[model samples]
Target: MKRLMFSVLPLMVGLALGQAVPASIPLTATATLMMPDGEAAGTATFTQAGNGVQVTVQVSGLAAGNHGMHVHEYGRCTPGVDAATNTIVPFGGAGGHFDPGMTGNHDSPQTDNMHGHGGDLPMLVVGADGTGRATFTTDKISLTGENGILKRSLVVHAMPDDYMSDPSGKSGARERCGVIERDSFETRNYPLPGPQDFPEGVAYDAVKDVLYTGSAANGTIYQIDAKTGNVIKFSDGGAQGRNSALGMKVDASGRLWVAGGASGSISILNGDGTPFKTLMTPRTPLPFINDLVLLPDGSAIVTDSSRPTLFQVTPELRVRKWLDLRDTPIEYQPGTNLNGIVALPDGSALLTIQSNTGILWHIDVASQQVTRVMDGLNNGDGLVLTGQTLYVVRNKDGVVSKVMLAADFKSGTLQINEPLRGLRFPATAVLVGDDLVVTQAQLDKRQKGAPETPFQLTRVKRF
Candidate 1:
């Protein structure tokens, strides 16, 4: 009896310790996502609840449709044009969809009772108007544990998951995804902003000498005194529809043209924020217009990240040419979610291929010839040119490289003369007065499970 008691005592003690201490008790760290074409990306925060997690997701610039949201198998997102090549296989290379030795359909009714897999979350549906607000809790897993969530990723599918379907649920494709890793000390400071930092869509028409800034999140687009960021209500539009001013431009005629993304029209605004005219977009399987760049030759170029091509449109928004500008085999980099674009003074245009690899290509506006000018920088987006120098912005490292352009376009040497450091995730930049104003799209990280940062615009003195 003594010997049996001694053996059983150790066994009882071991069991008690195991139950008392959870394996790291994996908790939510951060979660974020990118839009399909890479123009828009947001983050979220998550917290622990009983045995599950509560998540809050707030986003800007999402189309009104059923978007797929799920906790991915890993928590690392490579930002740049070539992110596809930068993806790290899940389970440290174990396989797809965090199974952890379990397998079943996504959100299977029997998931809890059976050997269930990870990577299942409720569907995120946005209205056709492109505005979305969602908050939900999940009982699947956490971010920290022997088999925690940080090792996984949060993904937004291109289509809605049917839930009980096997494999990838005819949910189209993985449109946008963000990583959830341990944030560095500096990264923590740039947490997602609250209701205070929302940007009012600012309209600047060089021809009209006016600027209008509006925020749909707050339901207002202030006609600001162009010299000052003060509100002047020249007009009002309901925020129920897609409220994104995806891209805005002022034509030589002093008219404002904007692609209201989810609203399905190119709206021309007068100096006082009044809608002058609306050109409806054609219905097709192609991606919608997110931005437009006016060319010197009276033509326009727009980016629709969904179709993997650049559409040249007339001022009337009619399609003139379709340029399939996808990266070639020799230049293909992973995670290339093509985004920002600009028309150079020389009549050529530059475009950004977001994520995995950073690259800018010079497209011959007249001949449709494309050539690679810069390679291997930060996540290249938001391009600008001044005199003989070209400026490219990096997303991941938050540094802008000022390169000196040579006389030769084909052989021009790109020298990083100035590196704009000490900023957040700088996505796009514009020439604001004598200063180069840059936008911080916020950290792709998450809190306990709120959404990632929306977008913030900052400036740097060019003196």
Candidate 2:
């Protein structure tokens, strides 16, 4: 492949730049970077840090080397065909580095000075394996009040940026580009009734047309009208266990069972969100009861991350250990043992191991034996089953996988028929009508400032 360097190649490209301050103050802005063919390579999330801002970039599908990445002036990522190489020129219309100050200096972020162009940023370093992560703090940008990068574009060059270059550093072609949207946690298509208490689990009542969500920090249960977006407090943590609610499910009888993440308890609520039964953890002192799936007899099979154990809540609310990771042959991390579960009709359940396994396994809840069902999924958080199909949600990286499970539950095939739509670190989901309502957990473990964002449930069409 030929290079598109300013010194070696002819200069035939021109880019337009613009700047605008958002009318409302936003806490965050995100950019979804894409390749020249308009394929999403990864995401760049900019959040409000201390005085400046923190940009965390997770990218893939690039050549191995240090690629120059910067914020451009335009919000457009228009692609055009190049006459010289007969290849697609990515983000051709996204203007050069933002340069609101017009200092016209290519100052690399590592050695940046105040006099450098505001658009100048640190080089985006990619690895040989096609994935990269670059986290940096910039005092030049803000996601808060005036003159922020609300309407800008992020550009990833084809080559490295030589810090002292006059125009755009000696970076090569614009391989990847994305538009930075000025959206915050507060802004959403759905209306939230009260302050978001950082919810992680969600359950939809198809018969009643109401959606149930719970707070992971306080165990406050919220009920929202699926059609009108009307929200109200259902069950306060006082009546139920006051632990952090993590996973939730409404059984066939309309009873809701909620998993207490850190408190190691399971609380059962009536269809009206009335407290029914509360079962505390067994044996272990520190437990992370993460997710749960209901059996045919209303027994809940819960995944405990820190304990490497599965607790079963019987129909009469008797909680006991149903499975143990140490008893199985599958190798996995202790604390990150399992998350997200789905029960089959034949008394078998599918579970997700978050860390080492990174795959789905079918387990006999009665025997405590597990068999591998599928692999290649990382950080799978939640799964919803409808007939023979399962939709698994990966919380750390927002994406859903549609898997078709066989009738015997012994085999399943994973297919990516279409790319998943709209997800902000989804934690759990429930199918409501034709749309699936997903709860944004906004897990604060990895990202610096995420849990502060308003927790929301996004409804997306299920394929």
Candidate 3:
């Protein structure tokens, strides 16, 4: 048995270097300001102009007076303990002003002195209505080079800058801050062969450099060349005794394992699309096998969405009922119950989601004990787990949620719900290198008899 080692450090490094602004191309960046208590302060935008840059800032919910603003060295805006007083300080993680030139002085924005810090900017004057706006251009800073502001922090101070103070402008305290991010990445789409393919699941074969997508409308499987973006039919659903294919994965031995949706079956095929075997479950309540994950020992754990049950298929192809959650806190609703599943790297436990109830549950493989981790993730259809970061694809919400789980997997924090462009109703995603290729499963449109032509799989980089 081989262990799954997941790490995102290399991917993070690639993204950081990829965001460096090219000298010939125009650049744009933005930041959403947040207050100490997690309130929306405003936004800031930066655009490349000539040899310098143009900056615009708009803010609200502040006292009617001047506020000092600057670009900080770090992109973090979380509260931190103050070293001087041992008290919590808001937005203290942003560190000090951005000073790439090693300058220790703070001067006017119009200053040409080398001692002036590059982060020194004009004051923001708030009106009686608690709103403020500032727009200016300066050659002291740029979108590229040593003084570039990408991946930095924008901060607003409690008091105004006197334009001559050293180190800091005597600007009482840091009131609000936002992390600056580039707006350069775009989603790339690859066309599927069928006009109404309605692909629900996607799996990448790193060994062959190919991608496989299963159709929800029909059980037809399509193979796509990852390098050339060419699509071809791999197997006919009807001929293969499959009604629908919802979730699928490729094991290390080059065998494809597919979860038969509403068919109560699991299909195993060779790398050449040759049928290996098919295992069927009881169809008392009309089982909906939504998704699955391959364990370190070559066995597979599958999720039955219509019931609060999980099925396991051993490496030798023996099938049996694995874990039943009927007596646990997880309830089986009228619609989808347990949809997506992922095993821990250590193969000690598994994390599964309840779509109807929006709850995440952790199950111990050896003990068969279930613990409800968290809720409020309604419509979470498929899940992609890398290290402690989990991505939940919400089909109805048309968004993908990024969550950071604790080391023990008993708790997690919802980071952000990002909406992907051209995502009709994303079903599931597979990580290919640093990109996430998501299936655009327009199930709603398919039921309405008006799905968009030539369904697509969108690739999102650094998601």
Candidate 4:
């Protein structure tokens, strides 16, 4: 071995045994340095070692120079850098290097030479060609457990690592960064063990103790046996019916409400798969009907991003109230798209506002008042109320935070349950008493015009 010194230690090891692994974690990442600007992008691959990890990173497209690199306190890397200071700050609020021991001090190879802080790593050097590669290992990091490594972030510094510097690298600031999160074994192109196939849309039927999923590509609804994970196609709703059958909700009355996106219609089905009623949106008009939620008073709230309005619908499939985001005071800007809907126990509902603003709005059904609940969230997609705590899922950031519901829903506190890591574009969520039913929607951008595949449905039971 040449013993090349690089930063962002790679802890994942490549296995030649060929045995299938359930979860593969990202142990290493590489980055290139853009000269004056100090911008970069690269890929990191994580592998498993004995009871440890190994990582390999190859990054290119940089300004060409030595860039400081260190594992950050959070894994999410977005918006690039801090504009004012132009430094690398962790998304989860840079909590002193990843030192589980409460070390409180940054150690370099020379200065303290203690090898204490998880944020300490070798520097990455991007050559004149704007490329860099580094491979290293760290036994102090992991994906699971209270002392796991990735609960922090990996940041790229603007200057070269001095190796003997204290605290920060003296490398100016962090130009690029990415938060390390747990990798789900249920991804398609990513690969995992067991049966890696899924039908399509997921619906929870407590009475049946099974999950019903519809496949738009296959034009069939598969009833998945919960305990066994075996799937059997239950119904054929035709090509159009299957293609548009994206959102599904089971009301208290046991009626299954399906939103036919491509078909521009809503179909109400009996528990036995009988179609009781069908309501379609206009043809010549616009907007795709994305989500629907049946209220307690026999009313439904529907969302159409194309029209970009939340409409209150009657049981007879009539539009009763059209809630335009522009009219609402909850900061629904132009680019922000609305997604999931959940009706609270007190008749209020929370709507997902997918925007950089990261806002979750509370809507009072009786008064039609929209209150800004929380902010600083990216892709505020799924909202679910479990007991007195409300969990909001952020899509782009891959985080699920719990919000407390005090006397009035307005001035409550919020805290993140750091354990539930590795979530990308989390869409729908349901409360099975205290446990959460979360659906992971991973968009595969590898193939052009290809719909994302290999979605995951997870049941997160937190104590």
> Taking the tens digit of each residue's C-alpha lDDT, what string does model 1 give over 1-463?
0000101000000011112312233233465656644454677666545445566665556677776666654444543222223454222221235443345445542255135555666667777655555576555644332224543566666677776665545565565666555332111111223333333233355544445443323334444333444445554455334355545667777666665544545666766556777665555554445556778777677765454566666755576435765543224334434556666676665544444456556676667677766666546655666776666666545456666655644434544322222344454555655556555443332221222243344444552
- Cand. 1 Cα-lDDT: 0.50
Report the number of the highest-lDDT candidate.
3
Worst 10 residues of 3 by lDDT: 5-14
TM-score of 1: 0.49
Q: How many clashing pairs per prediction, in order?
A: 51, 0, 0, 26
Please, what are the lDDT tens digits per residue for candidate 4 over residues 1-463? 0121233432331111222322233323222222223344666554434333465666666568877776655444444344335565433243335554345556663222134555566677788997777666554544433234443566666688764455655765655555564454222112112132322245778887766655433335556556565656555556335454556777787777776655667777777776767776656356556667777788888766456567776866676446766777754445536655667765565444444466666777777788876665556555666556767665544456666766566544665432244443445556554356555553211122222234456665532
- TM-score: which is higher, 2 or 4? 2
- Ordered list by TM-score, greatest first: 3, 2, 4, 1
Worst 10 residues of 4 by lDDT: 185-194
What does candidate 4 score in Cα RMSD to the true structure? 14.4
The C-alpha local distance difference test score for the whole of candidate 3 amounts to 0.78
Q: Give, for candidate 1, the lowest lDDT window spanning 10 residues.
A: 6-15
Per-model TM against the reference: 0.49, 0.61, 0.62, 0.56
Note the Cα lDDT for every prediction shown. 0.50, 0.68, 0.78, 0.54
In angstroms, give how far residue 425 of model 2 lies from its true place. Answer: 1.5
Error of 2 at 351 (Å): 4.2
